[model samples]
Target chain A: MADAALRRTPLHDLHAGLGARMGGFAGYDLPLSYPAGVMAEHLHTRAAAGLFDVSHMGQVILRGERAAEALEALVPVDVLGLAEGRQRYALFTNEAGGIEDDLMVANRGDHLLLVVNAARKEADLELLRAGLPESVTVEPLDRALLALQGPGSEAALAALAPGVAGMRFMDVATVTLEGTEAWVSRSGYTGEDGFEISISEKAAVRVAEALLAQEGVAPAGLGARDSLRLEAGLCLHGHDIDAATTPAEAGLGWAIQKVRRTGGDRAGGFPGANRILRELAEGSERRRVGIRPEGRAPMREGVELYDSADALAPVGRITSGGFGPSVGAPVAMGLVPAALSEPGTRLHAELRGRRLPVTVAALPFIPSNFKR
Target chain B: MKYTEEHEWLRPEGDLVVVGITSHASTQLGDVVYVELPEVGTVVTQGDEIVVIESVKAASDITAPLDGEIVEINEAIADEPGKVNEDPTGDGWFFKIRPTDMSQLDAFMDEDAYEAMTG
Candidate 1:
């Protein structure tokens, strides 16, 4: 997208002042990298704290009687069982068992807060308004979300928000950050101990500046964010998991609680429950798996995967692929036949008309460091 | 020294030409991770895609600037691709080619012209 037509985050000036290289992503003219470059920024995040401007993501609040029960009707997760001050990863499913969008739902005692992908925010709002009862209020907040992630993230954030250091993984709370009341969640896309702080647009710059001023905290951009998430094996909404990908096929069945499964108290109520439950019980035809290319050449997305070097047709294709700065090598994720999804299974990815050897490895090239 | 529109810098060394991308190109590529160079002694034509460079952000190609035979290959860059980003015009040279027609070098831009075009 053109820069003039794209939306600017509240931290656009801050990023520009920090010498970040700007690019368009999800209708926003955001920072792709800083002067430190993507490789360095990624490594910095893995080693220390990296602050990110994720205001482009959508934030919404749902409030009403039986709000959790109403939300359970849209997603397969057991929302009603979610405890206050805790967060759960959820996905909106279509009638055909495909994922509409993956989101984070936090139970904030009286109301539930949702953080959805930027590109799907509008569609998700429409889904909420149409599927939800008139009594339930779906309020979209014009807020700025900043993510502070890495090993040093706790120390950095604790300096600003005193009680945040005590928060466990996936825990959410309304805290005063740098004297600004913000919703703070001890969770992030990177597999690191971090916090996602939702603050007003006016306070965004001040909070971001405060975090960056802390020791070991540096400014990161979308490029580093993508690399970090890929190493953590987290799926990008549009790339790894999309409308055609079911929760089972994407290996996200762990997010579905037993209460929402078959033979439970509230089972098969969400959209495409029949197909999703069946897939959960039996299995899906194609499964997403981690792939490691044999050589230095990186096999990127859209690369066709074949069962054999001489195969006339491809059995699967890579969805997300890149050079993992933390892993010090190239890592990828792709869909293949269920039978061939096991780790150590050999597959061939076509690159420049030549079939390159790749192995189906376990997900998350690096072990996760979540506080949990 | 001459430069191609594709950001490749050609420097005459003996009867052969040493080819590498300009600093501007390397800065744009941002942290190259892998480089696939052509085989030494392979005959190439002008505009033929010969070198494949993979950076952290994306993959790109360095096409042949003139009809020539690959005389020598820089194997160091193939092993350590980051050198291209460190010193794109010096130690990061991709290959040395013996041109069939030396007159083709005149078609490329000079230092001032290349700087103007890139500017």
Candidate 2:
């Protein structure tokens, strides 16, 4: 379908004016890249900074007394203990111990802020409404989210809102940006030191233009964002973690805080907690591990993985695969048996009619540069 | 010189025909990272997929313009596939084929017709 027939963000005009090649993501018509192209945009975000329009992602406010306590019933994370003005990674799990969706929840002073994936917004909204008590209110915010990411991002953002620099990673603050009120969070998906600014649609272009005027802040697209997150070992919602894969299977047990574990005071209250706790203690049978291609051949998703070179018995399948520009190598991720997930273990990815050499490398083929 | 409907470009070089993806196709694929070049001495039929080009976003197939025997393959693309994006028509040529029937070239579009089709 044409980009025009799809939903567009407030920054569409700016992206079009910058000569970006457009594509469909979720239900929005987003920029795939500007004139700089994907490789340059990826490298640029790693070295400098890249501006991304992530407004399509869902943002909601959970208000009322006992908001955190109400939320803890649906997720395994220690939501009740989350400090004000701080963020935490969470997943909405099903009763069967599978992940419904992965999301970010922040403890605002008066209310809790939740950022869920774009594709699961409607379902997640209904899930929350169906589960939460009458005292709790779920309010979806119509705010535009813009992410300025890289080593140079803080400096560029601090120029507009000086107090933002004072907040550490996962910190949130509502401050004035270009004479307009905007909520700023010191977090991003790229694993880089960056900030996600939530502002009104009317002020999105103005704030983006002001940030772009700074040195080395190029506008990026969803293509670069996907490659960036993959290199960082972060899971994409439907691709890496789905309704069929549990947090333990996806290697996301760390998101379950210690206070919410078996021995803690409030243990095993969230949905699928019993199974998740069991898996946490014993480990899941299948594990998600990184695959480093030995050759230049880029083995893509759905390719069957084999135990040995020239072997026919299929062992696993690739979930996400591509050339990681920052790593300067082809990187992929797939589920394999527990015994085959160790780093440096040799494996094979069947392509065409032959089995190509692949090694089980550690997750995050590239190191994360999040500001500590 | 001619262009196939699938955007494969062919240029007659003496008795051999050199093939590459059109500049339009390369730009659409974004950054080309890996390419599977056709093996030399392989016999391919007209319009068969013989080469695989992978970009960061997707993978695309480059089909043969005519029935031919692959003579020479470009090994440079294996080490650095960005050449496909840097120069789609020049250094990024996929392979050279010795055509089994020269009349197959007449089925492709000329420069003007291909330009109109792409635009």
Candidate 3:
């Protein structure tokens, strides 16, 4: 285990004062939960509003002449079409159609803003530096990012940035928050209407405190964050999609633009375009499927999925599994044979020495509340 | 009743010993979300890992206090693991055991000694 003193977020003191159970995550000593506990925090986020300090996520700026062109070579997303003050989800892919990481690319007026997973930040930076054209510049914004999510998030953010409620999903704007200039986005990992505020390390404490002071907003930790994202049907890096998986297989085909398809203008341009295009045309051999366990026993990650036949042939392996707070049941996503990926397809998950019955289900077990 | 340094408490119940977690251990572990107990007929040696307990934060192993055969397990903990957090040393008793050797009890610490060690 890394030493607890190694890294600290801006909310460290505030979380400690609130009696939070501290844990090491993404190189920061962050709260695992407050005194209200994980279940309460999870339910709180689903019901009203919850504040999360995701400052550990890597924020970067790609600027200069070839920034957009250079970034286009790395991911399949159409970055050139993204208007200023708009954000889109993109994936970092290897030459073998494997996902390096998933990120949010925001078109800041002067530079392209990229927000990536905390654990994969260092490697992602290295990949960008090596592949990005020399004319483009990459700079890391080592600061605090806070996510205010749930139904009441719109009103909470509107209180700080007037007219922010008019911004649609995936829209970014630079707004003055508590007299400090910060970037706010109508986007979040939780399948709820929310905003992600990017503030300076020094200003994060004030912003978080100001938000938490509002009605129906409480501090949530990584534990609740995971459950919320899972219930939202979002794929977590390293768990749901890794180097071994492709975007198509992970059910993220919607993210790939129609212009990048086989007969389109930008055909065969991005890395892994050949394999990715093939998978886009002809489905992958294995695909990620949501599994609903028959009983309350949670089928965890790495558990094998077996066919119900007498031989009990192994067909897939679970990637992410946990209790879905909104659904009030145990749900999981697994990489199963493409034939068995259809919803309602019955399968079994091997737990301990017994095989538990499971059925494939539509993801986001609870319907997403995104502001369409 | 006596407790082990591992924080398991064992109480004499006729020829059997009823074992459970200590209050100190429960409080340290936070909310108990799940519990996996050994089968009734499973044979366990002293210091053997006999149960798996999980909180939302992490999972931990609960060891057997002495060499014994599990005679009965508290199935209630399977459904409501929080019972362990509510009364770890009393109503949260995990299982009863038929000791393989009565001399194993000598290795355990008494209530006063256990309390002093914890302090």
Candidate 4:
């Protein structure tokens, strides 16, 4: 086991002062929840507002004349077409067409801001350092990122930064807060209207404290964040999508630009282009689909999926599954044969030696509330 | 009545000792959402994994405090595991056990010792 004293987030003291249950997460000692518990924190995010310290996520800035071209060599997304102040979700792929990591890339004023998962940050940075051209400088921004999510997020943030209310979803803006210039993005992992604020490490605690003072804003931890993202039908790295899974099979084909798919002007140039283009045209052998358990019992990750008619043989594997706090039921996403990926297909999840009936459902178990 | 270092309490009732999770253990676990109970007539030894308790944060194993056979289990926990969180020492009693070795009970910690260990 790793030492608990590995690293501490900027809000570590604040969370401890609030009597939060602290735990080790991605090498950082983070809050799992406050005294209100996970259920209350989860419901608070769905109904009102919830403040989350996501500073553990990796933040990198790429700068140079050919920054977009350098980034395009590693990712499948069309970075050249990304307008300033716009953000897009992209995947870092290997030469074998397998996903190395999933990230959110935003075009800042002169540089590109990339936010990768916390666990994969180090590897992602190494991959970029080795792959990108020397002209592109990849610098890690050791700042703190906070998320204010749910229906009341806009109103709460608008109370502090008034101009934030006008920013559409996936829009990024540079705003100054109390003399500190912070990057605020109208984006979040939770399937709700929210904003992700990136502030300097020194000002992180102050911003979190300011947001926590709002009417509906309650401090949420990783526990509620997992449930909330599960309800949102987001794929968690390592659990849902891994190095063995390709972007096409993970159902992230939309992130791949159509111009790049066909032999257009900027086509067949990125890493794993041959395999990715083939999968784009012919489709993948397996696809990620949403699974809704028939009853309350959750079919967690790593559970084997079997045909409902003959529960003995395995046909797929559950990558992520859990109880959706808002949906009030057990929902999951699994990689099954494309034949079984269709919505309404009947399957069974083997949990604790018993087979539980599950139905293939649409992604985003709960309707997304993005402010598009 | 006696307890174990593992936070399980045993109450002697005729030839059986009723087993339940301690209040301190339940409080630390927060809301009890599910309980995996041991089946009746199953033989278990001291320190063996018996019951499984799950909260929102994570799942925990409740070990057997004495060598015994499960005479009866509280089926109510299957329907409402939160009872354990509300009153762990009362209605949340896990199961009644018929001791296979009475000396195991004598080796267990007493109420004062259990409280001191937890405190």
Evaluate all candidate structures by whole-model CA lDDT and list the values in order.
Answer: 0.94, 0.90, 0.87, 0.87
List, residue by residue over A87-148, the lDDT tens digit for candidate 1: 99999999999999999999999999999999999999999999999889999999999999
Return the DockQ of model 2. Answer: 0.81
Docking class of 2: high
Every prediction: chain A TM-score: 0.99, 0.98, 0.97, 0.97
Top of the candidates by lDDT: 1
lDDT of 3 by residue, A1-372 (tens): 236565888888888888887888877888888878777888888788999989999999999976886798999988888999999999998899999999999999789999999999999999999999888888998789999998888888788878688889999999999888889999998888899999998998889999998889999989889878887889999999998799989998888887777887766577788999899999999998889988766777898999883435788988988776667667888999899999999998887768889999888788888886
Candidate 4 per-residue lDDT over residues A1-372, each given as its tens digit: 235676888888898899998888888888888888787898999999999999999999999998998898899889989999999999998888888999999999699999999999999999999999899999998899999999999998888888899999999999876567789999898899999999999998888888899889999988889988988888898988888888888888898998678776788677788888899889999999999988666667888999874656899989987767678666789999988899999998887777878999999888999988
Pairs with backbone N, CA or C atoms under 3 Å apart (clashes), candidate 4: none
Q: What is the TM-score of candidate 1?
A: 0.99
Ten-residue region with minimum lDDT total, candidate 1 chain A: A1-10
For model 1, what is the error of residue A232's alpha carbon versus the real structure, in angstroms, after optimal superposition? 0.7
Q: Local error of candidate 4 at A284, Å?
A: 1.2
How close is every model to the real structure, measured as TM-score? 0.99, 0.98, 0.92, 0.92
DockQ of all candidates, in order?
0.94, 0.81, 0.37, 0.42
DockQ measured for candidate 4: 0.42
Best by TM-score: 1
Clashes in model 3: which pairs? none
Instruction: Please list the residue runs of candidate 3 whose C-alpha ends up more than 4 Å from where it truly belongs after superposition.
Output: A1-5, A309-313, B41-43, B100-103, B111-119
Q: Report lDDT (Cα) of residue A101, candidate 1.
A: 99
Instruction: Return the lDDT, model 1, position A37.
Output: 90
Give the backbone clash total of model 3.
Answer: 0
> What ranking emerges by TM-score with the best candidate at the front?
1, 2, 4, 3
Worst 10 residues of 3 chain B by lDDT: B52-61
